[model samples]
Target: MIYDLIVLLRQNPTAEVCHKSIQFLFVMNVIALAAVQAMLILRVWYLFSDQKWIQYSMILCFVACNVLSLYFTIMASQNLKLLNGTIFDLGKHGCRASRPPNFYRMFMPSLGLHTMLYALTAIRALRNRQIFSHAPVLKRLIRDGGLFFFVVFATVTFTAVGSFLTQLPRINITVIYSNYLLSLTSIAMSRIMFSIHSLASNLGSSTEWLLSNVELSRVGWRKGRNENEIIVERRCAGPDDEDYYYDDHSVLDIGGGRDDDIELAHVDGVKVRRSYDTSRSKSPMPRLTESRVGVYDDLTW
Candidate 1:
């Protein structure tokens, strides 16, 4: 921004200066928008359990949006027609870009994805609102996640709106909003990540109780007293659920919880499944002949 101000706002700005400034703005916005989407996608990813369809759909949408954004960015830059504004200058802040073609498509993917992810994140947070205040991890997910979506949504919307405004013959606020677009996206994403990490550091005291006492559908993880076990307690809510205690050593394997491991995802993407060395046990668990608990494959990353 400082570099842009120094270069483009000069009393006698050269053609070379304008060209570089325009290209640089497009490149920076493209990178910033991608960073913003990637981070938002990650946050939403954590809120789902093993719902592969939801996860896969989101991943596909993310890839498609970024690909389109990149393609449109190149197109917009090539099609960009800059007026010298002697050529009726909009002062030193910069002048209107006359779009011969689809220049506004540059930020369209960003605008669409921001709106989509914001809705998804908001819905996920709402689903967990009953435990919102109690679950520290979930609390940060909503608070930090909401703030991130709101800021990015407004920033992209502003840039998108400004691009539309530039299409009109009389409006010339494009440079000002474009400057905000490039700076705000990067700043918002990094600061939110720092806040999430800080929140994670302090959640240790509150997380212990929430882990063990809470049920499977409501709670995310439970830790055991010793390294040898990850005690996942279940207060079965369904009518069909019964007390079925499997004595097989495999049932207690700490690779997360038997076969139906409750995967714990750290806010910043570190996934953990504690390892237990069963061979070291003084009394090896007896194999069970029958059990009512349903066993399934562990949740995929």
Candidate 2:
């Protein structure tokens, strides 16, 4: 579409063609910028998943940004004009747009939106700074989100500031700045998403990262007898890991005593228990429930 727009403008050089090109650029640029903001906002949304206010606030800002973008799209379309009130000279290779003094208003929404997103990401990172060591994925997310915000913020700022400058010495530096902005926006967004996609694909092997965010219920994981004299055996591996208690004969007595009621720890040190009554068949009523004296309440994370 960009290439075609350029070609059409150059070939025809008509007033209608220039007008439509501006409209098209405005619409496409708004969509691209909005998509970038949405992704950045979602990063904050996920980080503060339990905070209702944060989520609602981000949603409101996102909606406001879109509405402003729509309003400004119209404003820019009507306001911006072709440079020197003329078409692209075939000899010059391309056309240049002549923007109004207040043309920067069209990009104000993006600057404001990125600022808010960056602030939110910063505050959240500060609040959870202590957990970064334990949660590498979360740390990387915050880092990447901040970088994305800065890239967008700088893009918008440069475009807005460029509106104030004009042609110098027969060369317009800010000419076709909008096209440059679009290209940068698309490239940055794509690269970030590509990195995230690669990380997500390897999530299965990253159990520690998963455990850091996962909410495991202690009572829910207790498998067997409810009233067993449970022993807390903490290992830094889940049941699926080789280091789990299943392999150790001392934990499960096949040759002797069978009072094994153990609580296994999660990879992040949260405990979830499972018990087995091996000598249930030896009793007359079978399935004897062993109760732990003085410890009735379940442990919390």
Candidate 3:
């Protein structure tokens, strides 16, 4: 902005200086846009659990957009010329693009990419409506991605239209605004990533208690003083004959529970059977499980 002000304040600024500034701005915009797209691709990849087809499709879109952007950028650069005017000029003093009326077309690919990402997120959200409806992270992912896409899509669309209409003034303003939008997108994505990580951590911690306590209690077992043990007793069996025995170091394994070692328990007066595997890993952090719990159960954690 200071550089812009300086250029505007200068009288009879050299054409070379103006060209360099334009080139620099164009390069910065391209890099920023690419970075924003990369982040969006990553977000989508995570949203889909890194599905190969989805990742490849996003990559193809990125490549296509960059290729088209490159072609249009080269054409614009080749046709770029300096002019003396306050209407379409980069500066009020003496800096403006004299040619390349279709320069705004270069940004159309970016707009399209943003739209594609937005659609992907929306579709994913809709398809996984049951999952996202209950999951705050998924909902926020869609919300943030949509908001970012909307802002960028709107700006790029307006800029593209302005370029088509040869509204150089609008194009000039939007060029600057495009960079601002890129920054905003980057910040929004970063926040979403942070939010997801935090939510995952919290969910892991909270679920560990359920996995150990509630699940064990259903079997008439109480958590022992040590984290690695639980005391079990049969409800119908007499105390003297009942086996108070359980693995002393039976660490709860949260990952796909052992299918064969199913234990039946009376949970809330309803019989329920669940599988649990013992963990040997030293790390205490709970693992994400793939097993599905019964309908009456809170979760198969």
RMSD of each: 11.1, 11.7, 10.6
The model with the greater lDDT, 2 or 3, is: 3
Q: Write the per-residue lDDT of candidate 1 for residues 190-242, one digit (tens) a residue.
A: 88777766653443332223223233354344433334333333454333222
Give the local distance difference test score of model 3: 0.60
lDDT of 2 by residue, 33-55 (tens): 78877777767777787789979
Best by TM-score, which number? 2
Better of 2 and 3 by TM-score: 2
Off by over 4 Å in 1: 1-6, 9-17, 84-101, 167-172, 175-177, 205-301
**In model 2, which residue pairs have backbone atoms overlapping below 3 Å?**
none
Choose 1 or 2, whichever is better by lDDT. 1
Q: What shift in Å separates residue 99 of candidate 1 from its native position after superposition? A: 5.9
Q: What are the clash counts of all predictions, listed in order? A: 0, 0, 0
Off by over 4 Å in 3: 1-12, 84-94, 167-301
